[model samples]
Target: MTLDEILDSLEHDIAVRDDGLFAGRAIIDGRCVDVIGVSRGAFVGVDEALWLSAQVMETIRRGGDTPILVIVDSGSQRMSRRDELLGLNECLAHLAKCLMLAGQCGHQTVGLLYGHTAAGAFIATALATRVLVALPGATPEVMDLPSMSRVTKLSIDLLEDMAKSTAVFAPGLVNLEKMGAVNATLDPAQPLAAQLARWFDVQPDRADVRDRLGESHGGRPVAARIAQRVYELARHVG
Candidate 1:
């Protein structure tokens, strides 16, 4: 199938009921999303993120080894008035905070990227132990190249020139690493759990890496800081 065809299915999705706990068997490195949808109510991305996060905590309270595989085939956040006012960044930050706590609780979170991941939504997905990605098929960026060029009103040619030896200007896996977005890319054909198992071995230290991400970019992304603070507060409050 063509790229557009592959990317099309993610646009409109159904939600599954997870009872607030993202607990279930995985695809063995296969796509976990297809197995788990809304699990509660509407399949809207931001709300779905919020729900799963709450579930993750419940699972942790119950026991050990809650290794959840969050397969990311998402493109971007749905544009909506409520979403804007509700603060998409806040919703995403909520999920990232949960994922970070999951790690501290001895859970291994893994994300298998199968499509474009950008902005705060991208940040939410990659907040894992070690991110396993597909081939060139998956695109990771803080802000995609086109958007950056368009919003900044800079020419694509000029941006391409900057990305020549620097990732600050481009949007890709390599560029993301330079920006400290994801940990590693996986071969599209590799099984997901196997990769996650490997990641479980060489886990990406979340807070440290996030600190680097923020340091490299001058300030951490707002969503990132919120998540960090959430964890910290949760610690003090508890």
Candidate 2:
């Protein structure tokens, strides 16, 4: 869906302006949300990352505990020598930190994935949100099959077969949800307004619990135990 379609689906009163980036306010179900994101599947780079983090900080300064809605429709980080020279990795990490900071400061940071996104762009945007909701037809690729094949030194065919058996490292909504990356999946056939409102009504506390979710879903059965052990050991040492 287009950005306009997404805003419309929320039954929101919003005014989104674009100057190579999208930022705006959306009032959904009488709840005001600050919306910021990229569009048209653009490749995120230093400038885009900085803009997003700045928007989050601006929202934080507003001092309302108002929810932040990060709408994502982007590709991976820019893969140019110039972007590398400009400290793209640090910029992306800053963006992610800003989102996490918003949540820590009492804002409900939610991510809406209505279009394609992958890699660092995905991490700095959607994955950083406290709760990530995937819209129908949203495509979130963790790693392209070819890239995964190259990285793991496994054939693309083998990866495909493995994906059928394990949600880990796969790139679909069902797989992502199973692995606890996606917190919710919006149903277009339902009243989107009510669905969103219901989510806020029963939203979980802003704590990182994906590891537990992964264990329960059997997508990552041992990760929670490993994390618990690591946390306990670190606490003991401290």
Candidate 3:
């Protein structure tokens, strides 16, 4: 879905201004929500990441404890010498930090992935949110199969076979959902407005719970345990 289609699917009154980045307000079930997003499936570069960070920080400064909805339809980070030289990684990390900070500051940060997003773009936006709500057609991937095959020095067929047995390294909604990356998938056929309203009423407060969900879904059985063990060790040392 296009950005407009996704917003329209909310079945709410929305007023937005866009300049590749979106900042708007929507009324869902009579509750006002602050909506922000990246448009055009952009290849997130340093400039885009920094711009997004500023927008989120400005929302934080507004201090309404307003619920935030981050809509995503983006490609991976820009793969170019210019971006790298300018510290793209730092900018993306800053963007993710800003979102996480918003959640910490009493804003209920939710993500809506209505279209394709991958790699750094996926991580710094949707994954940083407290709850990520995905639509049916959305695609989220850390790495595409072909790219993975190249990196791992395996044949595409072999990588495909491996992916059948492991959700840890593959791309697709099924794998990502199983790994607890997607909090929920909204049915486009249903009334999205109602479904989203329900989500707002019951969304989890924890900023990050993917590890626990990963364990429950059996997509990543040991991640939670390992994380806890590491946390305990670090705490003891501290």
Candidate 4:
């Protein structure tokens, strides 16, 4: 097995042994939030990510901050042919939307990954969060390099190079860092709850290292600045 696959396999084993759910309580810089994650039971399969959407909304409705820390370890999909056939994109989009809603509603969405966090599995966790915490051994690649070659008809080496850039379609933590996909590549030994508590306390508006990443490496902030200017101009014009 490749180094990446081995790491992912180890993570998948550990998560399985640990049993998937870890719930915790803390005040993130005085903002009350109940952090939630997954491991076992009802939360399995391709449909699993969708389950958390309502839970997030309900947390907001109750005047409580309910941030989700997704513990991703599953492969792309196995029994999800039905999901794909039945418009899986929309299903996945709804889940992504819900995670954004949590972020917009003053709740922090976090992704903690080990094992193989690939497929829709990658998007479900990575795209939703304001901050992401991953172990050094984690394999965040979009797909094993060979799969991309088959689908895209590009040389594996070229595809590997492109995936390295976060601004491009590069998967994994390093690429995600540039695309503004993940906020932090944290130490796995630090404990999930403790790290979440720390970032949660830091208000999202302030530019942290993660925010600076997009601005510095990818020049992504240029677009944001333009958007901000457009909004201001529209307001004055109106």
Best by TM-score: 2
Candidate 4's displacement at residue 110, Å, is 2.0
Ranking by lDDT: 2, 3, 4, 1
* Root-mean-square deviation (CA) per prediction: 8.3, 1.9, 2.2, 6.6
The list of candidate 3 runs beyond 4 A from truth reads 10-19, 202-207
Between prediction 1 and prediction 4, which has the larger lDDT? 4
Candidate 4, backbone clash total:
5
lDDT (Cα, tens digit) per residue for candidate 3, span 1-238: 5677778766444444344667777877777887878767778889889988988899899996878888888888997999999999999999999989988888888898988899998999999888888888888998999989889898999888888988987798888988999878888778676777766665446536798997898788999999999999999999
Off by over 4 Å in 1: 1-23, 27-45, 128-132, 150-153, 177-180, 189-192, 203-207, 210-238
Per-residue lDDT of 120-175 in model 4, one digit per residue for the tens? 65665555667776656566655666877898899988877776543545656666
lDDT of 4 at 17: 34
Among these predictions, the greatest lDDT belongs to: 2
Write the residue-wise lDDT of candidate 1 on 1-238 in tens digits: 2222322323314333443223344333333322222211122355767766766666568676556556554555545787868877777777778777777776667665556666665666554434444445566667866888999999988888877856667777666655555655655354434554566554435445655564465433454667779889999999
Give the C-alpha lDDT of model 2.
0.84
Each prediction's total of clashing residue pairs, residues at least 3 apart in sequence or on different chains, is: 14, 0, 0, 5
Q: Estimate each model's TM-score.
A: 0.65, 0.92, 0.91, 0.67
Error of 2 at 45 (Å): 0.9
| Model with the higher lDDT, candidate 1 or 2 | 2
Superposed Cα deviation of residue 20, candidate 3 (Å): 3.2
